[model samples]
Target: MGKVTGFMEFERLKEASEAPESRVKHYKEFVVTLTDSEAKIQGARCMDCGIPFCNNGCPVNNIIPDFNDLVYRQDWQNALETLHSTNNFPEFTGRICPAPCEAACTLGINEDPVGIKSIEHAIIDKGWANGWVVPKPAAQKTGKKVAVVGSGPAGLAAAQQLARVGHDVTVFEKNDRIGGLLRYGIPDFKMEKTHIDRRVEQMQAEGVTFKAGVFVGEKLVEGGITNLAKESISPKELMAQFDAVVLTGGSEVPRDLPVPGRQLKGVHFAMDFLPLQNRVNAGDKLKDQILATKKNVLVIGGGDTGSDCVGTSNRHGAKQVVQIELMPQPPEHENKPLVWPYWPMKMRTSSSHEEGVERDWAVTTKEFIDDGKGNVRAAKCAKVEWVKDEATGQMKMQEVAGSEFEIPADLVLFAMGFTNPAKSILDAFGVEKDNRGNAKATTDGEGCYRTNVDKVFAAGDMRRGQSLVVWAIREGRQAAREVDQYLMGATVLPR
Candidate 1:
């Protein structure tokens, strides 16, 4: 610990952000990074706890105390090194990971947790500015070929690791861009695309080839999953050409509400609406982009995706935005004694929610009301309560007797989370799936991450179902180690 008693002396300071009214006017990153002195104080707040549960709390197990100490001592470069040693993209996680590590911090039990995410943001941004982040090409070539499907966080981490270890890695992305979700799913207001672009340049310099607009499956995916592939590759061809194949595609199958009037023209999935705006922001002219302008927008689902919808709708100059959740609202604050050192269920308000939105919970949509022109006009909803069934000993939802209502809505976005990965890719590779429709793969023991088909592996969301980007990176790095061992009979890569 750089400063043993610093935690007791310093107070937590949040990163400054653009005001809600000012930030919603455009699509760009609004949160300003902590200054050098501010970051040092934030880092100094890390208590010298005996056991660093923050490390375990983090999905990628970042060396929190070490980095905090380094930052506190003004060793910025070493802090960046420690951060990159665990997380492939601190910029991504620092911006959108929700900071589970902070929730598990010892200081959080009694006081505000250390601003670890802010320190990380400062370290990475400083690293890039000072040219500390650069290409780390391999010392020697292994002469082995690897194919990574999906260019999201997981696939990118795996490809970077394998490439650094002297293997020829080619990443296949179905979209015209490299980053699968980071490029399209996340709004630019949260993180700019330049971050992903620079990483692509660095990976290319490290000898990792990126083939965009190329689908690596027998057939192209349809429906909600975006597939801008100009070419398709068969599984047999990929197996014959590459020594190993890793499936790191995201969970793209969005959960749908199969209520009445679901066929309305103005009702769409969040994916179908979000990516268009991103593409437009990237200077891709879209002919028929979905707009929330001058419309009363209804966002169903109360997760990050729904919050994102709220932000985007506000940016589009929407007339009004109302977000609803089927589940009851959680407490504003969690009971720390009961849920310490673990993620707790509580009311979370995002920057999008702060902009402007009418938020409601425990309301279920019964149907999408249709206008005369086959467009969504409103949503009929009802309040519901969770009651325990004595016979079954399970909680079930029941609608209130006289709580039915309707809200005006010209645009309805289904922001409910994704269910599973596209079925076509897994079926093409002959990989088995678990009961949840995710690719069946273990995380420990022998031959971990290997799929049923020979030379085929699964990782990230494809294997673990829909999850955080940090988890995706962890699985990707682990899967790379497994694939390397399988090929070279040994691996120096970390798990």
Candidate 2:
């Protein structure tokens, strides 16, 4: 540890952010990275805990203490190396990851956990500013080819690893741009697109080929899932061309609310609404963009996606924004003794929620009211309570009597999370799926991440269902190693 007693001396400090009122006026990142001194102070707070539960707590198993010590000692280059060793995209995770590692910090048992995410943000940003982040092209080229489908964190990580190992890697993306969900699903204010663009340039320099607007499947299928793919390659053709294929597409099938007015003009899935704004931000003009401007927006779902909707709507100059969740509200604070060293269920207020939103819990939408012109007018909702069923030993939701209510909503967005990947894409590759509709693949033992289909492997949200970007990167790295092993009889790449 750089400072043995520093944890006891310093209080946790959060990164600075623009005020909610001012930040809402534009679609740009408002959260600023910690200054070098601030980050060093944060790193000093890392105690010499014997176990380092934060390591296992992080999905990618980042060497937290080493990086913290390096940063504390002002070894910026070494800290960046330590960070890049575990995470391919710290910028993404630093901005978006919920920091489960912080929850598992030893100091968090009583005091505030170290500001690890902020320190990571500072390290990566500094790395880029100093040109420390650059292409590490393979020393020699391997006479092998690999195909990575999807360009999100998982696919990008896999492609980078394989390319660095001297294999020819080509990433296929259905969208016109690289980055799957990261390109369109997320709002610009949360994370700017320039981060993804620079990485793409670095990857290209590292001997990785990116084929955007190219879909590898039988045919393109679009049913709310955004597809700007101009060309489609058959699965057989892709299999014949590449030595191995990695499926890292996101879980794009959003869970739907099939109320009476689901067919209304103004009611849309969050995916359909979010991507357009991102495209618009990228200077792509659309004839019919879904706008929350002057509309009373109602976002249904309590997760991160719903919070993003609230933020985007506020930026769109929405009249009013309301968010409702079916589940009961969690406690404002979790019992540390009961759920230490693990993620706990507690109330979370996102920057979007702080911007402006009428948030409610224990409420379920019964129906979407129809405007006279076939547009959505409002939503009929009801308060509900969760009760345990003794016979089934499971919790069941019960609506409260006479607790029905109505919320005015000219625009309604369903941000309930995704269920699974596009079934057609998996079926095209002849890959089997689990009961949850995710690609069926185990993460342990011999030939891990290999799908039932020969020469095909699955990882990230495609195999694990919807999860954090860190988990996606971890799976991608592991899957790439497995694929390399399958190709070369053995692999030196890290698992």
Candidate 1 segments whose C-alpha is farther than 4 A from its true place: 221-225
TM of each candidate vs. truth: 0.99, 0.99
Note each model's CA RMSD in angstroms.
Answer: 1.0, 0.9
* lDDT tens readout by residue for model 1, 105-154: 99999899999889999999999999999999999999999999999999
Deviation from native of the Cα of residue 258 in model 2, angstroms = 1.2
Error of 2 at 151 (Å): 0.4
User: Over the stretch 93-122, how does candidate 2's per-residue lDDT look in tens digits?
Assistant: 999999999999999999999999999999
Model 2 RMSD in angstroms: 0.9
- lDDT of residue 302 for candidate 1: 98
Residues forming the 10-long window of minimal summed lDDT in candidate 1: 217-226
Clashing pairs in 2: none
Report the Cα lDDT for residue 72, model 2.
95
